[model samples]
Target: MSITEQIRSLEELASVDAELKILEDQLNQERSTLDALRGSLQKLEDKLKTDRAHIAALDKTRSDLVAEVRQMNQQIEHSREKMNRSRNEREANAAQRELEELRKLLRDREEEIGKLTTEAEGARQGIEGTEGEASKISAELGSQEGDISSRLSEVESQKAKRVTDREVAAKKLPPVLYRRYEQIRSKRGTGIAQTSDGTCKACNMALPPQLFHRLRREPLLDQCPSCNRIIYFVSPAAAAQPVKEG
Candidate 1:
């Protein structure tokens, strides 16, 4: 094939390959973002569940405290009723002293109920705080989910467009030039390089004067001795020629 045709073919192939690489990198990034978002969502869900369980336990504790307090009140009422029926009927000083002691016992139990009520109030406040925190976390997780979905969709669309562009550029090359370019790219990571001022751009090696002069004649495809890549001279006028069949 003509040198210019070879360069154009290789250039188009390189463009397509570069675009495909970028698309793959972007796809990987998008997938990573999705995975991280899902993980955060799962963590938030677990935290919410744990918070709810703790709140439920706190509620049960408060309820039990209230029931105990009610039971204490009932006992105090019964004791008072008994003391009234006795009506100072006990003539012994010891009996009067015993009734006073029972009254003191009821007073102590009342104080205990008051302490329990305060503790229950504290527990209720804690439950409220946990619920608020859980709600905030849930809302954050929802927003992340939506954001990740939107980002992934955008990446997918961009990737599709890049792939289409790559395909179109690949089709511009002749079949043989296209196949050779693909083979070299797969094996060496680059299929073509420019030879300018006696230097091979691919390897940055100064070509021998004999080789550099030979390339100027546009005889045939030339592989750089140093880098093993097809070398072409870039010229705007020569770039439009059709590739000659070998």
Candidate 2:
């Protein structure tokens, strides 16, 4: 094809691509809401796992504390028997001091067990609250997913049609030119921009007078120096061609 015809085909492809981009943005926006909910649910689940593990550790510590208390009680009982059977004042005083120390240690340990019991209870309640919240979100997701899925499905079908249209448009161009367009589009998100005057709309930089004049005078496919996108001129005569009534 001549350069003019190639430029026209590129222009057509660019138009289709612009529409495709809008659809793509819409898809991302829609998916983001669902993704955010899923992310929140995942965090809750992780917290529940951590809290349960903590509760289990607390229970183990409490059990060990209880065993220690039992041993302390046994020691206190033996000390009491020794005091009752003491032969003299010195022996009775020694047994009394030992009994006091053991009782104090027992009291401290029992207090710690109480605190642990409270902490474990708090963790259990937190797990219950987290579970409830997770259930609510799961239910919400189940309710919302049907509508979101249907909407996404419809958009995907539209997107697929445009993808086929893009393939058709791409096949019409020479391989080298198409490759160049794809490369530019990968970097700039667009491959071409039209100019009626000398201004590059993509970058908003005015083209040099000589460069703009050449593009207007010739059937050339040129790049905007500022943005490096395939640039073409829109002549007044061509722009003035009336749209036909369908």
Candidate 3:
């Protein structure tokens, strides 16, 4: 391959590498979103469990109150029958007062039960809301997971193709040039750069006339002074040619 052809190959590699980077970023973003959603779902589940437990405890308390009130009523009824049989007027008066006090206690217990039932109902509503939020998070997480998988697959395939192309291009270059390209690629994430209209395409630096002329002749492989990237002159003709033609 001519010097211009090599430069063109490098440019193509850069383009592919750029695309690969974008896909990788997108894949990473999707994975991040999936992780965040998973955390949210976990929190929602924990909240639901706590709410359900609280509601269950309230229900148990309410049932106990109902049983206690029923026992109090039975005691009052037995006391009234006993008072009627004995004909002890003062004792009957004491029994009646005790029964009245028990009735008041029952009324208070009933009121507490009503309040507790309301609280339990509120807890149930909270649990339902948490469950619904968890479901939504699960669905969103599933979608993100699928997108990440698909994008990762595409990135891997594209990366493989880029590797193959890079290897092919390396074969066409001199050993010294290839080595220099590798060094620059490691440092700057790019192996080669084009010299365009007296400027380095990699760093957009205007080159000295002497350096520009040196690259135009394709002497030894050149590195850009500003960017440290391997610089080569791009032939207008080579740029116009298609990859298949090359």
| Candidate maximizing TM-score | 2
lDDT of each residue in 1-246, candidate 2, tens digit only: 999889888988987888898889888987997898898899999999999999999999999999999999999999999999999999999999999999999999999999999999999999999999999998888888888888899999999999999999999999999999999898888888666678776777899898899888987888988888888888765642221111
Best by lDDT: 2
lDDT for each candidate structure? 0.66, 0.88, 0.74
Residue 134 lDDT (model 3): 89
RMSD of each: 8.8, 4.4, 6.3
Residue lDDT tens for model 1, 31-115: 7866765676566567657656765665566566567657756665665667556645564444456557656765775666576
Q: Which regions of candidate 2 fall more than 4 Å away from where they truly are?
A: 236-246
Lowest summed lDDT window (length 10), candidate 2: 237-246
* Worst 10 contiguous positions by lDDT, candidate 3: 237-246
After superposition, candidate 3 runs with Cα above 4 Å error: 1-9, 29-43, 57-115, 136-159, 164-183, 235-246
- Supply the global lDDT for candidate 3: 0.74
Q: How accurate is candidate 1 locally (lDDT)?
A: 0.66
Count of backbone clashes, every candidate in sequence: 0, 0, 0
User: Considering TM-score, which of the candidate structures 1 and 3 is the better prediction for this target?
Assistant: 3
Clashes of 2: 0
